[model samples]
Target: MMKTRVCACQTKDVYLPERARVVASEPMTATERFLAFELESGRPLGHQPGQFVEVSVPGVGEAPISISSSPTRGAAFEMVVRKVGNVSRAMHELKPGDPVGIRGPFGTSFPVGGAMKGQDVLFVCGGIGLVPVRSAIQYVLDHRKDYGHATILFGTRTPAERLFVAEAAEWARAPRATYMETVDRGDGQWTGSVGVITTLLPKVTIQPAKTVAVICGPPIMYKFVILELRRMGLSDDRMYVSLERHMKCGVGKCGHCQINGLYVCQDGPVFRFADVAQIREAI
Candidate 1:
């Protein structure tokens, strides 16, 4: 079969983007849209959790976007894109069948079946941070028997800002799965907890030493969340974080994502807390 490659620039160029067409597109919020794409090569994006890909639009440019859906779920990969800049704004204008260029399933990934196997998995996601952590959450749930209990804690500023309405409900229903969510401020219809994500942490009991926690959220949120986790007995080495950095080039050479000696694009967008704790700029 003939494949429709988006860029004929050849694979020798490390930045070459292959062709992909959007298979599904829906608005998750006023400013964010959920999109799914199938590579023209007829293969899956084959990405692991906590990784991102650089999307390219000819007239615009490239922007790094986290893979929001679990690789275990489907052939097409998904992303949660916010209309914050040029590339993303252009991405929002795309429809179900529009063609786009995809570069990689780049960067380090969460250790799901590896280090997390047979261990309790706890996920803490805040606001848009949930966008990337959702991938790991889905992986853990998909292979539920391979791990112990699954606890998910999510928080957003307001009810309107909550993402993944349907999926959140499913997580709550899964066996051996614990899902709790909160909004900093609630509305008339909001009946759940009302506070920052840290407030939800105390409600769940975890065997901290045997549990591996994956956290992704705002910069300010990390400090408080980690402090609370330490108070709960989880050590720095057992906790992981996904960072949002300025990774202009998915390759390490760009230096845009450098924090001390590490390049987030190559070293990680995802890292174990203890490994990066000393790098003042990394979080």
Candidate 2:
């Protein structure tokens, strides 16, 4: 167990975790919770959209979690965690003012501030996949004028499993933005579209030339979603994907996330679809 957390961190030391304080922790669903943390060093996390951080607890261990808030949000960073393992279970036990360990803010990020600016931005997310894509959504919305028409498409397995309900609704209502949500299975409370996320794609229109698509979800979702995007005329070069499933150790030393010449933790967790299209395991 950690006696006292480290207040500062060195990027050169890949094994160390910088101490951060929990500013807020709240439940988003039965199994998932929202956590916001502020670095004890009083500096911003400096993460771009679609990046992730490796988190730890005193007696438990470490897990890589996607950064759910945009870098434009503020000094603090946020994550929506599902209680599934020792570290995540311990993270659920944290409260306001408690200390936590954070490593990384690793991996590549969405091109919202770079190649994506001035072009139409399209975001496609599924279930908990929204946890990472939300950062780019927040960044795009925060600077809505920097891009063209913004379109967001989200789908979950069920109604109760929906994360960021209120915020997603707000995104739907934003000026110059279009938001649509669906669930594979819906309950009485779920009044939106009912089907896989691809069903909603046909109902919308986009500019194939100017639009940039950013996707995140399970590997299977990536396959089908890209199929529909391809049918819709979006090219692989204009698309980006988040493969957070392959994350491990938050560094290249661990080959758990390696695919041939690519290391998901180091080279990317977010990659241009064209760059990794030929790698069978990249999705």
Report, for every candidate in turn, its global Cα lDDT versus the true structure.
0.92, 0.89
* TM-score between model 2 and native: 0.94
**Alpha-carbon error at 131 in model 2, in Å?**
0.8
Worst 10 residues of 1 by lDDT: 6-15
Residue-level lDDT tens digits of model 2 in 1-283: 8587654443367788999999999999999999999999999998999889998887888888999999899998999988888888998899999998899889899998787999999899998889999999999999988999889999988888888989988998999999998999889877789999899899889899999999998778999999899999999999999886647688787788887789888888889999999997787
Estimate candidate 2's alpha-carbon lDDT, on a 0 to 1 scale. Answer: 0.89
Model 1 lDDT on a 0 to 1 scale: 0.92
Local lDDT at 148 for model 1: 95
| Among all candidates shown, the one with the greatest TM-score | 1
Off by over 4 Å in 2: 1-12
Alpha-carbon TM-score of each model against the true structure: 0.95, 0.94
